[model samples]
Target: MERESDVDALIAEGAAAPVDGWAFDWLAGRAAEERPPWGYARRVATRMAAARAALDVDTGGGEVLAELPQSPPLLVATEGWPPNVTVAARTLRPVGGRVVAVTPGAPLPFRDAAFDLVVSRHPVRTDWAETARVLRPGGTFLSQQIGPGTVRELSEAILGPLPPPADRHPERAVADAEAAGLRVVDLREATLRTVFHDVAAVVWFLRKVVWTVPGFTVERHRPALVRLHDRIRAEGPFVAHARRFLVEAIRPAD
Candidate 1:
């Protein structure tokens, strides 16, 4: 049995590798589909309308920003990954949104209270405080992110017993928002169940889409892969799960 600490170290290390091609393309397509006039696009638009100036954090592929109206002159986007920032700039150019790459979990480049609205999708929790710091009084902070139990089954199968829940909890995020002097008005979790052709597809998706923890050795996961394949072959089309939390909060008027 591997010690919990050992497992964590491995996952942290492996998370930086490029995600699988199939999974990356699938996510890119999903981002395009989930844009405006459809589902969350309406909500995002509504939020953007309320702000004089807007800042989008981690604007991956700029799909969310692209859906909004091209009216906000001060629209700016930041992505932590260089490649993602480059892609976002191209994707958001038509909407006149400027994209810049910045390090996650650090002070934002903008001045304090500089933005009227701050939006993020799947941003690192470490940046929550900085997000609040950058928003003006009464500014809205809207974020959508993966919650705990995201890919729980795959994680458990590959890593043995599940680890203790970390800060990814939606409740904890609400608390973090409140602690950062932001009022949490809406915090909701949406679970989406997706189907894949086979266990191999599922494994590839996890490698690319989910980005398993750093410590996960491809070699160590081979047995788990075999087991998953066997199970899927016996069970038919496999069910994969994903969860996203939609949170809308306001920086205190004071």
Candidate 2:
């Protein structure tokens, strides 16, 4: 049972795979996920072109921040994990932005009214109060966030059926931003197709994207992995839906 070559490959590749940055190129052929039409990276680059000062929160390895077409005059990014902090600093240096290792859920290290634009792709948790505290009046906040029940199919494959998502709704984001004194000008949500061609792809995915199934390991979830492998071989590809939301808010000029 444990000596299956395909399963062994899956476990070995996943366990050895690098899960440092936010980039997902490793999943290119083995897995695929549709992109949101709104183009969050393009939006972020546009915002960066206009803003003098900006902050990128929870910038995993600063990979996304490094992709900005034009760098802002004062750009800063934050990461909570120590390993990611090192990686982020290296990646962000060329863009002239520094990565600050911050404590998750702690107050941001920056002073009040320090930045005119604040952006994050998918933060662990959005501290609206800190976001509002750092953003200057009339500043903009643009983010593409993970929505409720993203990749539920993959999740259930790993951990069996689960309850609906409780935390990641976009409506709650609007309320929080509003409470933080930011005007929510736009909100959009999308559910996109996601597919895994093989068990290794799924294994690598879960290992890299920890939130999919925290503490997942080949030894721990071998049975589930075997079942999923069988399903992929019988069917074409394991299909799932990924949901994401985009929110654009502005701090009032007043």
Highest-lDDT candidate = 2
TM-score of 1: 0.80
Over 2-116, each residue of candidate 2 has an lDDT whose tens digit, in order, gives: 5488777876786688888888888888999999999999899998999999999999988888888799999899999888999999999998998898899999999999999
Total clashing pairs in model 1: 8
RMSD of every candidate to native, in Å, equals: 7.2, 1.4
Best by TM-score: 2
**Per-model C-alpha lDDT, please?**
0.69, 0.91
Pairs with backbone N, CA or C atoms under 3 Å apart (clashes), candidate 2: none
Predicted structure 2: lDDT: 0.91
Residue-level lDDT tens digits of model 1 in 22-135: 114533322211221125656778877766899988777788788786436589988776767777888888988898788877688999999988888777654667878899
Clash counts per candidate, in order, are 8, 0
